[model samples]
Target: MSTAAIDVRGLRKSFKDVAVLGGVDLRVESGSVFALLGSNGAGKTTLVRILSTLLRADAGTATVAGRDVDRDASGVRAAISLTGQFAAVDGRLSGRENLVLIARLRHLRSPGAVADELLERFSLTEAGSRRADTYSGGMRRRLDIAMSLIGDPRVVFLDEPTTGLDPEARQEVWRAITRLAADGTTVLLTTQYLEEAEHLADRIAILHEGRILVEGTLADLRSLLPPAHTEYVVRQPSLEEVFLALTQKDTAS
Candidate 1:
């Protein structure tokens, strides 16, 4: 098996003459979190789609989970899972049902057991029977991710997983993502949130103009930019500070 969970070189794609990914290269280590940071239309989604086998690159080679993305597409598909921007849960079905449905589709022997296991793992056992429509944004996102893991894929692609989520909900999802890497699942995440990348990624690549502008740890990337200057200000004391000083003086007296 390849040491890298994902490997790409000279990747290129275009849509009717408008180039999306132009000679991009990336490497994601096994069991690590790699964040691709880009603004909307910067080709992050396009790159992910290509890696996940949903789309093919016009040029370049990609190997995902040790299988060539083009030559061994099926192998790539079998070893990876993807969750897109929006939660892909069925609103009418309960959380448990949604997982069971995915398990069945994946040809698991006992779909019900698989569903229960995932619910417990995601901390959704208490709400497993509730309709997905009733789930909070965080819960639904959790369920969506759980469904993606039905096959226990080696690599998981999360494209803007926290989009539209509240701050608390986003934090909840972040914890779940962190747990995935700790459990030895290689996560390739695409997001526009700079803080999200900094918080979750072991390494990050900034994609701009269909190319990688920089790739490294947070500190490494920061070092490439001009140094920041800090300004110290001295200001008049507040009323609280003045009162504290008078109280101390009286106590000493």
Candidate 2:
């Protein structure tokens, strides 16, 4: 049986009468990739924030890595890392410097060795000595994620980690994400790119109107659609096509 790295029950959050997360419930199994799918303002980031201990929930409970997010906030923080939409790298510092800085702040011994290890792990060793400003979007994002792993946090929350990057750069980030999962790190990724969820997630949950409309493995979710028959050519629709169809059906009903 797989243990849940992150769990939530009846989570609710609101701002001035606006419900951002209205009774959200979710679970992410340890060492698996769980993707959260939603459009803009669907409260994916809000949920990630709540789970990561960055923002408090108005109601309900969440536990990360066996620690209660509210009652054991520090413990939750210690067991998880968050990579937001933007790459949080300083242009003035070299890639190695950034990693070393984070490792040092985390109070880990041999910060230089820690930085060097991550640099090689993320395939940034060749660029480690270069200033972050010189690195491409993908390289910078990889460095940011590598820095996040200085303490080997069990759960990682990535909120649109590949946004604004070109296709090639996106692939680079995708490889990094794959490596994270291969190393047995639980990832809860929020992405608007349906193809991204299709490629990386072990299970996916669709968030609509601040609630989970559906949750299942890709094949399981695909079962929600009726089988198609073609007379001339049999074509398989992509995840984007299926997602749009479902969401439109939901909205139209």
Candidate 3:
């Protein structure tokens, strides 16, 4: 059995005349949170969809949780769960009901027990009986994530989990994601929020122009560019100066 949560090499994809992904390679260790950072339309979603078996790559090999994405799609789907940019719950259904439905879909025999556990775990116990449409944004997001955990997925793909959330709500979701990874679940997170990646990722991979511009730990990546530091003269030190120095920016700091 392979311990790697995900492995991809020479991954290439194209949408008609445009190349979306060009020779991408990634290797995520078991139980680690790997953040793939990129701007809009940078193929981050495409990569996540392909790994979660929602989209197929035009070329190259990929595997997830020891199952080949191309040859063993079922196995990959069985081992992975996807929480998209938007909540996928049925708004007409109650929180607990949504979880039960997904549990059933994943063929869980003890769907009731699973639903209760997740409801409590995600702090949705009070709202579990409420219709998803009536729930707040945070509550709905929690339900969406809880639904994905119905079958104890080994790997999860989170694409912009906090896209439409306020600061507090985003922090709540971040904590939930941390808890998931701490419990030995491998997470492939793609987000435009650099601070979010810095907070949660064990390693970061930046994608630009359909290729990985860089990949490394936060500290390591910072070191790669330069060793410039800033000593703020003002009593209230600004990170802007430090950032500019580190990034080798000549914007007159």
Q: Rate the local accuracy (lDDT) of all candidates.
A: 0.95, 0.95, 0.91
Summarize candidate 2's per-residue lDDT along 1-253 as a digit string, tens digits: 9889988999999999899998998989999999999999999999999998889999999999999999999999989999999999999999999999999899999999999999999999999999999999999999989988989999999999999999999999999999999999999999999999999999999998889999999999999999877678778999999999999999999
lDDT of 2 at 61: 95
Give the runs in model 3 whose Cα sits over 4 Å from its true position.
233-253
Q: Stretches of candidate 2 above 4 Å error? A: 231-253
lDDT for residue 97 in candidate 3, whole number 0-100: 92
How would you encode candidate 3's per-residue C-alpha lDDT over 59-117 as one tens digit per residue? 99999998999999999998999999999989999999999998898788989889999
- Best-to-worst order by TM-score is 2, 1, 3
Q: Report the CA-based lDDT of candidate 2 relative to the real structure.
A: 0.95
Residues 1-253 of candidate 1: C-alpha lDDT, one tens digit per residue? 5499999999999999999999999999999999999999999999999999999899999999999999999999999999999999999999999999999899999999999999998899999999999999999999999999999999999999999999999998999998898999999999999999999999999999899999999999999989999989999999999999999999999
Per-residue lDDT value at 21 in model 2? 93
Candidate 1 residues lying further than 4 Å off, grouped into runs, are 234-253
The candidate, 1 or 3, that scores higher on lDDT is 1
